[model samples]
Target: MKKTSKKNNNFKIPGTELNSSDAERGKKESQSNFVELLPLEVTSKIFSQLDIQSLCRASRTCTSWNHAIRNNDSLWKSHCLTIRAVCQREIDDDVKSGYTWRVILLRNYQKSKVKYEWLSGRYSNIRSPVSLPEKAMCPMDADTWGEILDAELEREVEKLQ
Candidate 1:
């Protein structure tokens, strides 16, 4: 039978045993050192200025940030309103459906992107009705369709010039 040495038998897991220096380092690494130090109003104001992508990233950073972003419906409402300029009908539908501002934005953000691509003529061939996103056709009225068509025609005319 092989006998393990006493020194070898006593194993120290790297982080399980913390010396004074390690404890100090751990304290320094806490989220409260930065974000939590700010007043809630200040944090909300800062997050309100961030764009959708930045706000989403910030929400994932920590519990406090998530709470700040989630609880402030006005912040998400402002973003939803901004996106409404690009996809008004979709935003209206989402509002009618009783979705919260955050949910409304999530639901329409992709649809708005696709609609913008179509309006800007980013796709070379928007040939068939099937080629367009389902949501694009559903909520858009005849007037909105006319506007989109006019915009596309204007873009084509600009390209020709």
Candidate 2:
């Protein structure tokens, strides 16, 4: 087997933290208290500016950040209500058109004689009184939909960050 070459030291990728000096800075950035630097007002603005998806994404970055975001029920509730509003449109349309149309429009969501479900979490079945779409979108049980939303929201927020 060919042995690894060391241009400087530490055997790290060349030009990328190959030496102790570079590694120290890399560690410093991760350790930096960037979160603490932002004041509460600024943080609240940033938080408010963030839609539900952004807040969820921020929660996945690390333990401290996740806990902070999760604790903010207002943010989560806002997200839930927003999703509910969007999906409620479908239900309203379904009602005007008829139950038969509900089946066709929500074909992605299969239905049994018992009930209807959306196989696609991105889409939702409108439940009357209009519950949150977090449950509606899943083609499967809400257990799966919850996971899907959690993952999707985190991804969206990370991309923005």
Candidate 3:
């Protein structure tokens, strides 16, 4: 009886084998190139040019990028300020909480989006505040609610005419 080694049965691809030293060298060569090559200031400047969404995507690409993006509070602060232009009250409340710039933006991003929708009259026939998502209701006060309702009413009236 002949015993066949399980290792010998494994399939090997042609020309794909690398010795341990060669594999290590390949790993070194293929190591993430961007952050390693660019100066920190240059990398930060490049990241700063990205919009919020692009910055977020870039941050997820690697650990170095994540560190760069998260550590740079000014990047998040700038985005929060831009958002503030459209949703001042929400941003103000977030800023007052004394969270980091990243947290401030995270906390208010959705609220700002919802508030913009309300202000822009994106939803019609909002007979009650319950029609809105719970997160949307919290940042808004009675006056903002009234404004949304008034805008919705105006939209409905315009449709009738």
Candidate 4:
């Protein structure tokens, strides 16, 4: 058997060495934005499928993703409508006031959660603030409080009868 030369001792397995061509290709792949590869309509449709939490998490992953998510108001609109089921007046007011879907959602998300709990009687039996769920309270407008109060009264009436 022929012996290998010392000069050839630095043998790298084929394709193991990252040559200029490989480096350039890898760089191109990394630099290519997934959002840019697709048409905005397609990207919006794809992102529209993501849930609110998933959309939010994906937005934080990269600037491109964030831009793609932020530029599509329809994506936010669907989630806002889901919240509107719980806070109808609040959402309607915001929409009528010319607020963007994203802004409307951000403004009402926490309020909706707290309001839903109250309206659903989740907190109907609480005797004091100490008995409330931790982090369950949010500042809501008078209309929202009125709705909650009305719900509580209805619950009381149901109990009385």
Each candidate structure's TM-score, on Cα atoms with residue i matched to residue i, is: 0.59, 0.34, 0.62, 0.80
Residue 136 displacement (Å), model 4: 1.6
lDDT of the structure predicted as candidate 3: 0.75
Q: In candidate 1, what are the lDDT values of residues 26-92, reduced to their tens digit?
A: 5555624345666777877888889999999988988877887887888899989987988888789
**Runs in model 1 lying further than 4 Å from the true structure:** 1-35, 124-161
lDDT of each structure? 0.74, 0.48, 0.75, 0.85
- Between prediction 2 and prediction 3, the one with superior TM-score is 3
Worst 10 residues of 2 by lDDT: 108-117
In candidate 4, which residue pairs clash? Answer: none
For model 2, the superposed segments whose C-alpha errors exceed 4 Å read 1-31, 86-161
CA RMSD (A), model 3: 9.4
How many steric overlaps are in each model, in order? 0, 3, 0, 0
Off by over 4 Å in 3: 1-31, 128-161
Ranking of all predicted structures according to lDDT, beginning with the best and ending with the worst: 4, 3, 1, 2
Candidate 2 C-alpha lDDT tens digits along 95-147: 46654431323332222211222323333334453564443333444544565
